[model samples]
Target: MAAKLEGGAYLSSFVDAVLEKLSPILEDDDFVLEENDSALELLGRLERSLYDVGSVLDDAELKQFSDKKVKKWLVDLQDALYKADDLLDELSTKAATATQRDPDQLQHKSLRELYVEACDSLKLLPLGDFPNLKKLMISKCQSMECVVVPQALPSLQYLSISECPSLVSLPALTLTVPQLEELHICDCPEINCFAEEFLPPSLKTLEVTKCQKLASWITSKGLQSEGLTHLWLGPCFDVKSFPREGCLPASLQALKLSNFPNLETLDCKGLHHLTSLKSLAITDCEKLENITEEHLLPSIEHIYIGEDCPLRWKLARRDGRPMV
Candidate 1:
C-alpha cells in the first residue's frame, strides 16, 4: 500500500512536468510548422489532453490507494503520456532539421571568404558556385579528404590548404579558377600530385612545404605554370635535387628552396633557361654539395645561402659570383 502511494505521487509529479514542458512549445510563435499542419494540430490536441489528464492527476493519486483498478488506470495513463512526449520531441527535432537544411538560412551566395578549421568529422566539401568568392582557406581538418569543385569560381584569387593529413589530391583547378593568382599548400602528407595537368596560367605565386610525395612529383614532373613568378619549395626531405631539365618556366623570377635535408645536386641545365630568374635562396640544405655549373646563375643578382650548407663554403670561395 505504501509503494502504491509512492508510485501515485511520482506519476502526479511527472504529469505536471510534462504539462509544463508542453505549455511553452504550444505557445511559442517562432516555432515553425510550415508544412506540418497536421503535426501542429496533433500537438494542440496532445496539449489539451495533457491538461485534462493533469486536472485528474491529484484525484487519481488519492483514489489509487483505495482502488487497485484506479492504480492500473494511472499507470496506463503514464505510459500513454510517455508516448505523447516522444512524439512531441520527434516533431520538434524534424522542424529544427528542416529549418537548418533551408538554403536561405545560410545565405552562402553572398559569402566572400570562407575559412574552415579543426572540424574533425568533416570528410568532404561539395562546394557550389560562389560567383563573388575571392579567397578560400582550409586548415587543421583531420578527416577532410576531398573538396568537390563542380564548376568555375570566376573571381577567386587566392587559395590555401594546410595540415589536412587525409587529403589525397586537389580538384582539377587548371581551368576552374582562371583569375587565381596565389596558391599555398603545406603539411598535407597524403597529397601526391595536382589533379590537373597544369596549374592555372594566371598563377603568379606558389608555395609548397613539408609535403614529401607532392615534392617528389613536382621534382619529377616539373612545376608547369607559364606566368608563375615567385616559387618556394621546402623542408620536403625527399627531394634530392632541384629542378629537372625544363622543369621551371622561363617566366620565373624568384625562387627559394630550404630545409631539404637530402638535396645533393643543383642541375645547371635546369637553371640555364630561367633567363628572368633574379633572386635565389637556398637554406638549411645539409647534404647539398654540387652545383653542376656556376656560370648558369648569370641573371641572378641576389643569392642567399644558409650557414649549415656545404654549398655556402663553396659559394664563399668562388670569385665573381653574386652572393648576398
Candidate 2:
C-alpha cells in the first residue's frame, strides 16, 4: 500500500524519559550537545524510524536489525544514563499526566516502565496496577535495596528490574500479579531465581544478568517445555552444574549463558527425551571443564560459548553415539 509519513510516531513515557536523560548528557558533552541539542530532534528521528519500521514490521530485517537494536538501545541507554534524576522526574511527570489525561490515546501505551538515575529506594505501587502494562522497568536505583511489585498487575507482558544492588529476590509467582511473556532481570546482586516458587508458563523470553545467587527453581529434574523461546542466564554468580535432569523441554529455541564463573559441566542427563532444542550458548564459564554430550538434544542448530571454557562440546545422537 501507500508508505506513510513519519508524523505518527508516539513516543512513550519511557522513550521521553530516555530522551530527557540523554538531553543533559548530550549537553555535558559539548560536541554531542552541539550536534544534538534538542531531545525533540532525537524523538523526531526515532519517530521517523518507527514509521519506516511500521511498514516492514513483518520482515526479519526490521525485527532483527531495526527493532532489536533500536528498542534495545533505548533500554540500555535508559539503564546507563546515571545522575539524571531531575530529568527523569520531569519525564515521569509527563508520563503521569499522559496516564491521567487520555485513556483512549494510543500514541504510545506501555504498562509499567520506570527510569531512576541513582535511587536509594523505590516506591512503584503509586504507579498503580494497570492491566495493560506490558513492561515494568526500574534502573539505576543505586542505593535501592528492596522492591515489592504490586500484585494487582497480572497482564504484565514484560518486566525489567535492573542495576538495583540491594534486590535479593522477587517474592513468589503465586503472589505476583500474573504471568508474563518476557522478563529481563539484570545487575541485581541480591536477587536470585526467576521466581521463588514456580516458572510461569506464560514466560517465553528472559534475559538475566549479574545476579549472584540464581538457583531457586528446582521444582523438578524435568524443567522442560515447548513454551520457552529465549533463555538467558548470564553475568550471574554461583551457577554450576546443569539441572540434574537438565531442561528436557522439547520447545526450546535459543539459549545464552556467559560470565558464569562457577559452571563446571553441562550434562543434560534429564533432557534425553528432548528433540527440539536449537541454539545453545555458554560463555565465560571459567570453571567449566567438560561437556558430556552423550545424550544432548538432536535439534541443535546454533551453539555459542566462551573461549575460557575448556569443555569439548558435542551432540549425542540417538542410540548414544558422539557426533564429534
TM-score of 1: 0.68
lDDT of 2 by residue, 88-162 (tens): 554443444233333444222444553444544343313443556656677776655555554456676777777
Candidate 1, run of 10 with poorest lDDT? 93-102
lDDT against the true structure, each candidate: 0.78, 0.54
132: Cα error in model 1, Å: 0.6
Local lDDT at 108 for model 2: 27
1-324 per-residue lDDT for model 1 (tens digits): 236445556766776777776776677654646446786688778778777887887888888779989888877787776776555554443333232334454344555887766656667755665767889998987888987777888888999999999989788888678899999999999999998777899999999988888877887788789999999987777777787779988899999987888999977888888989999899889898788886556788888888788887787787546456
Evaluate model 1: give its lDDT. 0.78
Worst 10 residues of 2 by lDDT: 1-10
Q: Judging by lDDT against the true structure, name the best candidate.
A: 1
The reply for model 2, stretches above 4 Å from the true place, is 1-117, 121-126, 171-179, 194-196, 215-226, 236-240, 246-250, 293-295, 313-324
For model 1, the stretches where C-alpha displacement exceeds 4 angstroms are 1-107, 320-322
